[model samples]
Target: MKRQRNRGRVTLASIAAMCAVAALPGQAHAADDPAPYAFDPEAATVRGTETNAEASELKSGSVYRSAIKPGQKLYYRLNLDDDTNAYVSAVAVPPSGGKVAYGDGITVSIRDVDDTQCGSEDAIFGSGEFARPIAAYAHRVIEKGNSTCREAGEYNVLIERKSNATSSPDEWDLELRYASEPAVKAADAQETEAPENWSSASPVPPSGGQKRSGGSSFYEATGLETGEWHDTIVPGQTRFYRVPVDWGQQIFATAALSNNPKSTEYLGNALSLSLDNPVQGHVDDTTLSYSGEPASVALDPLPPVDYRNRFASASDVSAMRFAGWYYLSVTLSPEVAKSYGDEAIQLRLKVNVRNDPKASPYEGAAGIFGVSDEDKDMAKSGQSAPQAAQSDTMKLVAAAGIGAGAVLVLGLGAWTLLARRRTAPAAVPAAAGGQQPPYGGPTRTW
Candidate 1:
């Protein structure tokens, strides 16, 4: 009988151990899963319609969330007056681990009620061909003497995804933003041409910076000022940061990756750094081949922000036409993991902002183009607008997990105690001094 009880106790303990082990793998798998885009919690969810007649209206200064599938063309409505310039940007986020081709991308355009296209732009996966967030923007500028899309009573935004048959079948999530810029006062409406002469030389990035963590998406991007910042990134991860650039100011940035002592294998295009304008328009990008040694890439010299830069023939100059939060994204190729041991590589950013801020000429709602004191404060704290909500969500999840774990432990303990009692004979009388026996004892330790 003693032998049987001991065996039963061992069996119950083994079963409990197995159950605990089984629960761990699921949690580990979830932790390893790719993180999804962090869309703004306050953003309204809207459905894209197939036709303009049924298109949903997009309000200015608002962010929206939607989705797009392969070969799908969707339309959203916009109501605007003739005086304001309308800028619309669409960001497509492909599922992580999904196969994407070089040609896969998204196109955005703005058209009038009569189907005349006001502006259109497309963004592709390019040589990287990796699953990531790609952004493009279209605008209906209130240009003088441009008769095409100036009168914007009822305009439509057309968004389409381009994908081949071999691409992933998963639907891409979309983030859309609409910004309306009021026309400049007549006295301030002089034609401001792009800079005639500016230094094309690259500025040296600052060294020995404060530590900062980059956001996973534009909405969650960490705010940065002109300075040196440091962070860490693992293979297959892309981190995003934003800098405030006001009119007449220019931004110069450089990204550097630290050497990895674990591996010296050379990988081509192992790192990339890209810059996007306030409206999410691509400005410039550079890549570096890594051989485990330190490597760096700096953006090409860009013109200062000016309203009249829209007339410039070069795309890079034109992209600097507006002033706001310019996004910087740094990506470490997934291939690096094979040789770099999946360890995080140290990253440093040298950022410089030049020129004094200029006064805006807008007669209405021009705050979006300039940086505010609050913006600087946020940057100093390295917090995004939605970070508080994200923190709250994490706290709730942790609390629930703790509550569940307590119940599980308590229930398992009770079951083990009950099983031991049922399998054992009635408790034996205590030894002469009321002490429990050493073998087949009734005293419970758990």
Candidate 2:
């Protein structure tokens, strides 16, 4: 192992040098499926326990059975949350109480609680599998018999019934036992992986961050009866906004209703408030949309409410309950949309698309939040703060590793020849026939 260790160090040093050189930009190509960065544990753990409420006690009809071999220990755990002497009461019944009277051919033993708070108890029944049904009360005979449930058979184990003379059964839990080789655990089952969910709405280009600009155009607010219809610029499907030459800059527009704030009802609330720009890229590019349209409406920042909007339906007052101004920011890509020859580019946004009332927590929120002053500075400077920090750490680690490798190679090369010289004299052993080899002289050894 010592020799192997030294050889491994030599090989590793060479590989480290190669890796360090590759760390330089353009020296190495990107790799697919990088090594995992951390270790995660996978084990089946009993996450505490639960019990039935007083209204629904573990009924008498509830029954469990076990098939065991001789000398095998069966463990069944019961959780008693509110009962102090619960374990003693449950252990008093015999498994075959409903069967024969004399020596029901079963044994029972109640051991101490396990280390866990759930308090597990070990009950060893008959010696062979067909050990008669030993009720909980037969624990003493089983202790004396020193036999085990050996053969395989169904032994109906029951939760103790409530006695009219004594108090009724309170809350409790039960854990059945199995004596055999551990089967394929649930943790080892195939994992269903889901792609990461909208990872914090990262900025486009993931480095330069983003810049926002706001502009306004003619917004005509129209009213209708409770169940009436209008040509309604239905900001839902697709509505266009005219941007004149003066509004030349990148345009981001939003809509809101100027109405009295209400708390609890879903009526007379804001409806489809969207804007469209022809010269801007599809607002749906980032999945930031409202009701299938390239638009969105403000959402509750705290415990958000459900919202749904259509042409002329009940208002989603949940969207407008908060007594404050709600603004929606629609990001536009001015360069791409200009290709479509339109004098005044029109952009499309959707405030509501469906009539369903299922609301999203992410709704009602305009742009993202949580950016610090430093983040803003980095964005303005066109520098990736996270990437910069990662690069610095990687460079330091790579540099230190390279330095260590160089020292190791130099030291090993110097010590290699010296070690050979020191071990040279002891390289040879007399022949197995108890005689020195005839041609043997000073041999070079390592």
Candidate with top TM-score is 1
Best by lDDT: 1
Cα error of candidate 1 at position 4, Å = 56
TM-score each candidate: 0.77, 0.20
What's model 2's TM-score? 0.20
- Model 2 error, position 367 (Å): 27
Residue 381 of model 1 has an lDDT of 79
Q: Residues 349-424, candidate 1, lDDT per residue (tens digit)?
A: 8899888998876776566776777777777777665653444445655565565566567667777887787655
RMSD of each: 11.5, 27.2
Q: How accurate is candidate 1 locally (lDDT)?
A: 0.80
Off by over 4 Å in 2: 1-5, 10-48, 51-293, 300-400, 415-446
